[model samples]
Target: MRADARKNREHLLAVAGAAIGEQGVDVSLRDIARRADVGLATLLRHFPTREALLDALLRTSFDGMAVRAAGLEASGEPGEALVSWLRDCVVWTTEYRGVTVLMAAAIEDPGSALHASCVTLRAAGARLLVRAQAAGVARGDIDGADLFALVAALAWLGDQPSLAPRADRLFGVVASAILTGAGGGDVEGAPPSGRG
Candidate 1:
């Protein structure tokens, strides 16, 4: 692709990602094209199908989280690293609200390009979860699957028609539950003990 064409493709992906994620998959391709100041043909060339576009958008977001997670490894304590990465994930999810729905749909149909990336994301998440458990910051009983579910739920929350004022509070609840110590006997939906 020409430099300009590449730029257009990236722009369309970014705009469509935010718009569809904030709105719904029902958002028109024409609208995305208009917002990107590109012709519909250009958009189609980059993202032949709506599913393809969504998958690309999701891949882009996951790639970002992966980079952030790697950086957090050396940032501070392991538990703190997990908290930082989770906050970053929440911000990404909120930016792309309907992403969880896309994820589910992709899972239901593995032929979709999004499925592989989703699986990769799951593996990456598991690594973070395990690291926290090893650090003794999180309860050992917290399963990796449950942590992934929490992330999907958070993405669903981000997809809301409007941003909830309690976005931070919700994140806090999630972080606290995952950050409890073994002796604390699992926070499990409880608020932070106000000690850490």
Candidate 2:
């Protein structure tokens, strides 16, 4: 694209990101254009569809997670790296309300604009899980899809006003379930004791 057009696209994405952060994924496209001080037609010309716009806005974050996965793989222990990345994914999903629904759909629809990025992020998480499992830290019974689902489920807990307070504790329970030999003699759904 031309330099000015590229800059304009970047500006639109920035505005869209802020708008979505404030109002969520279902925020009006027209409102995004207005926030960017551009005509709706201009925004449409650049992004054409809501999914396309969301794909553009979220692509960088997805890609960044992949890079983070690589860094963790190189420097962190398998189980710790996997858990850390999973925690980050859950936190990020909660940041954009209603995004877990979109991501869940996009992962299943190969034709969607967000599909490729979602797949890439899942693959990154899968790699981490496999590493952990190989080290006998994480449960081998689960796979990448399971880990992805856990991220969505954990994010959902954070999204609910009533459940948000317990989200952190539930996360530990889920993590313990995923990680083998994590905490001993633990009750299911009980928060891990701060021992050993």
Please report, in order, the local distance difference test score of every candidate based on alpha carbons. 0.69, 0.84
Candidate 2 wrong stretches, greater than 4 Å: 182-196
For 45-101, candidate 1 gives per-residue lDDT tens digits of 899988888877778777877777777765667777776776666566655545667
lDDT, candidate 2, 110-172, per-residue tens: 999999999999999999999888888888899988888898888878877788888878887
- TM-scores, each model vs. reference: 0.79, 0.90
Compute the lDDT for candidate 2: 0.84
Best by TM-score: 2
- TM-score of candidate 1 to 2 decimals: 0.79
